[model samples]
Target: MTATQFRCLLACLPDPLTARVVRLQRYVLVSLDCTGCQEVGVLLKLALLSARAGDLPAAETVLHLAERTLRALAGHDHTFAPPRITRLHRPRPRPARSAAAPSPGPALAGQVARWTGTRPLVAATDASWKRGHGGMGFLTTDGRWGIGDWKVGPQDPTGPSKIIITELRAVQLLLSTVEARVEMTVLIDSLPALSYLWRWQSGDVSALPPGYEAPHLRLLARRVADRPRLRFQHVKGHSGHLLNEAADSLAAIARRRAPGFDVEARASDLVDSFLTSWNQQISA
Candidate 1:
């Protein structure tokens, strides 16, 4: 479907979850193939597009499938050729300063009233694309665990293998599942991912410069952010942490499943982060 029709059709769905995914099937995943970064581009676009259309549920479904498919193919020795970026349809490159965009999650109250037990289970995650690496987590200020996702891959720029594409897919998994809700802070190591999410959640897509993934990032946030409590924070990368390690492993595990549908919470300790978004929406 054309972008205009896709957006209009989604506006008619009503339910944030259902409309979001249906739009993904129509605009993002439907045209995606087993090729290169186009899949990544489509996945990223699916996310922001979902946000714009306010169909987060459907967006989450598509995001999960995209991430799973990307990781499943990550180990192959062959470099899957991707489509070239045509001047007619290319997006602006990400700014170098975007990397320095600090996360505001750390500034949060840090005293999540739910963590009265004294120990915060925090999970920090990272992902790479064309070496496009980014990370985040679900945790408490005291290092407690929660629901979150991350990945490492290449920069598709305009193709399917882009890292943000997988990140969005992972975000969908964290939000769409039945077990993802709870009170927790999600710490991400990637600035691009964090900035896009932060801006979108705050209701401002222009917060970051115009990048290919900007539109997708905004959609991803809108799809999940209307609800309060759920937050994204930036963390230092390559740090040694158990929950973070587990998230990386879980991402790969998710890929073994077909198209990332029917996926459930395997990392039970931190599924709470995922829940906060949906819960707030439900209550709203």
Candidate 2:
């Protein structure tokens, strides 16, 4: 049968079975002397199917093959550019919380106030991903900052991208350094990481997207839920935001496995200058 006819038949099968059949057929096609657009089409189809089946590594491998084929066809002309696929796994929609839920009691509020004190704190967090490793960084306006790294291993559950995991880790590390009762606002550059926190705040169990089952997520969710005074806001990355830029720099340094430095002692000069400029901009 022709390639189109074979694909049509494959579509008629169940999703799980179809993915298996397509993966098997991909191997057969690769073994043959097929080096044209037809092969690229088949490889792309297999990649999509693998993604749907929650096999991201298989999908990435297939996409690499498809790109290789396209490059071979384009030669030195550089006319045929491969399509970019950003997200392979889409998360299941979370159910909204009831609007009539009870608010925190006055006793709880008093306890939080006593624990956190009256002063408020603000911080920014950022993350970096390279190869199979990731870095997380956070810096507070009070000169308290930290940097850490995560190495994705074979047994680790790394969801869709290491960057997303690292972003959440940055927030987690930030929260760990501060008191839970402290009135604080954290700025995060990653929308997905902020969304996960928002969903967790709303009592959504599926805050972590599909294919992500990290144990730390549950603890993070619980910590966020307990801290009613803690807030999160989105900050645009690489937009001349001083605190965000500092956090990003720290994450990059951590990703390179560089030695840690004292932010208070080393970054005091730059931080003071940025804070002055930022305050002036806000006042104007």
Candidate 3:
């Protein structure tokens, strides 16, 4: 049967939960022969859809399957490969950034207020793309940090992945470190990225997010759905914000090192120095 036929049958199921599980199973079937980051990507999208539909059991099951698939394939030696999707649609290009790009709409204030606390834990995330390589990094004011490159495997035929995708990936990495159910705030520099995420969190998931970043965005959406207290704050890039500059610098470092970079051994004084510089400048 065709994929459309299969999906139609799933939608006709009486129990929404059952239908969600079946849809997840369909992704698992696709993953059987698919060997790459693409397989994991598909599974994550399924999980995200299930979460948005309010089917936590189904989402968790798919997430578990994805984890198992990654573990099973961990020992294989392979290079980057283009995903074998049936139809890869290119999203329309977004317009250039305006000099005075308006702040996210007032609706975002209401959407964000539901998830914020008086003093939420805060972190800054950034992504960088150079020479077709993508990297993302995040750092909290209290010294927590993460840095990593995209999993495109260097055979990225779709050209460089969107910076928004890398930024969301950094969000995923940063949030993954937080304890479940706790309120958190993530400071970001990309307005478009924030808009994309807000749209998804508000249940407008009909269209795919830009590039191959849907899975990452979906994962983040699920995290938000489960914990409504997580908030995202947009900060101006290159405005001498200490943590933001540090995360941006780390992402640049990750892109330069590509494929293999050590985060643990990287110097920490740069972040501290930037914070000092930002403070001294502000005082001046």
Models 1 onward score TM values of 0.38, 0.53, 0.52
| Candidate models: Cα lDDT each | 0.44, 0.60, 0.56
Q: Rank the candidates by lDDT, best first.
A: 2, 3, 1
How many residue pairs clash in model 2? 0
Per-residue CA lDDT of model 1 for 1-284, tens digit only, reads 33433443344334654443443343242343335435644764565445433465656676676555555655421223343434432444533434344221110011234533532334344433322333322333342332222333364342543565555544543443212445545666667767667767777744533345434444546655664656777666556444444455444433332332232344333334533542355469
Which candidate, 1 or 3, would have the higher lDDT against the true structure? 3
Pairs of residues at least 3 apart in sequence or in different chains that clash in candidate 3: none
The per-residue C-alpha lDDT of model 2 at residue 132 equals 76
Model 1 residue 163 distance off true place after TM-score fit, in angstroms: 2.0
Better of 2 and 3 by TM-score: 2
Q: Largest TM-score belongs to which candidate? A: 2
Best by lDDT: 2
- Over 4 Å off in model 3, which ranges? 1-120, 151-161, 205-207, 211-214, 258-262, 272-284
Model 3 TM-score is 0.52
